[model samples]
Target: MWHMARPRKPLLSRARIVACALALVDDEGLQAVTTRRLAAELGVRGPSLYNHFRTKDDILDAVADAVCADVDLSMFEPYTEGAEAAEGAERAGSTDGPGAADWQDALARWARSYRAALAAHPHIVPYLARGPGRRPSQLRMADAVFGALTAAGWSRAQATHIGATMRYFVAGSALGSFARGFVDDAELYARDYPHLDEAHLLAEYQQRVDDGAFETGLRALLAGLAQPRDD
Candidate 1:
């Protein structure tokens, strides 16, 4: 009697490798991600990973790009396209226009989206500040921000600075752990630190406090960017 051969395991692909690496990082922080660990997670040999990635850093870069790909870049599209349309309309004597306010709105939306993406994968926050480099998703994000700003009448220099500024704010916000640092007990701060009387409140309203702070800072940054500039 002939028996059917067991179905073969799905062949490993770069996407599968990157996905497994990301899950590892998500579960156990970036340091937990190793070729051995990934291979084990994938039920493959360590050398099998090298066939897809040159080194651990290559896998990490792919992970970072994957995280960036999750960011909502659609926010920039309306403003970028609207600005272009407005410019064309202006040449045709139309009064309606997209302006600095539009750019500010788009940037604020982008900042929130960026922060949310990073917050969801806090494990990757440490690597994001290194800039997009050769990562296509991150590069696309940067290009969208730059394109929107420049289209809204910002000079190339100003657009570059704004992109950097937004990136700094979003990354810095994600890096902070203000709410998590507070203890739930009021007495924890009662003795030597009366100024910390509100410590319990922090634990009670941790998420609100963090979100409020982010929004406050984001609004302030966008407002400042909306100001008229000589350059």
Candidate 2:
């Protein structure tokens, strides 16, 4: 008996293209993610990529959206619905009802999650600063943040400012590269720069330093935003 050939799998798709492109960027850098390279990675012709994405920027936008989709916005659910608020409160073991204070807590949790997402994909952090534009996932995150702030009784202007401030903080922290920037050799700092002598110690505790600084700044920002403002 003659056996028929197995059906050929689909060679290309938007999701496949995007996944390969993202992996290329993760392994190499954003600069290395050319259409030709991506096509090769997908085992297709360079022009085949155009079937899914119009240009390299389109692919990058998808990658950025993928990163944004990884962020945990569950904390903001309580702000939008009463049932979620009750559920979240019960899960957190909080006897006090969800209120403005809960909004602050949710925002803090959201901020941390957002930071972690960016930290995991440091190569994409630069592209993120360009704003959400037409990216659906990024837009959703912005909506959740703004909705939570407004629902918590903050004025539209205040909420907008707070959102901008938080984005700046998260983006800045991801771009700083503190761990890789610190010098581990004490001898690198001469007497002329005595203030840099202890810098070597920072290399051993880079994570703690970076995390502590972020938390401190985030707390201060939240505290300030929580206060009454003339505006």
Q: Scored by CA lDDT, what does every candidate get?
A: 0.85, 0.84
Cα lDDT tens digits, model 1, 51-114, are: 8899999999999999999888897877676777888899999988564356777778888888
For candidate 1, what is the total of clashing residue pairs? 0
lDDT tens digits by residue: candidate 2, 1-231: 999787575669989988887787777879989999988877889998998899999999999999999999999887778545756888999764445448778888998999999988888888889999999999999999998877676778988998999999998997766755867787876554788888778878888989998999889988876553547
Candidate 2 stretches with Cα past 4 Å from truth are 1-10, 82-101, 228-230
- For model 1, the local distance difference test gives 0.85
lDDT of 2 at 34: 94
Where does candidate 2 have its weakest 10-residue lDDT segment?
A: 95-104
Displacement of residue 113 (Cα, Å) in model 2 is: 0.5
- Candidate 1: RMSD to truth: 2.9
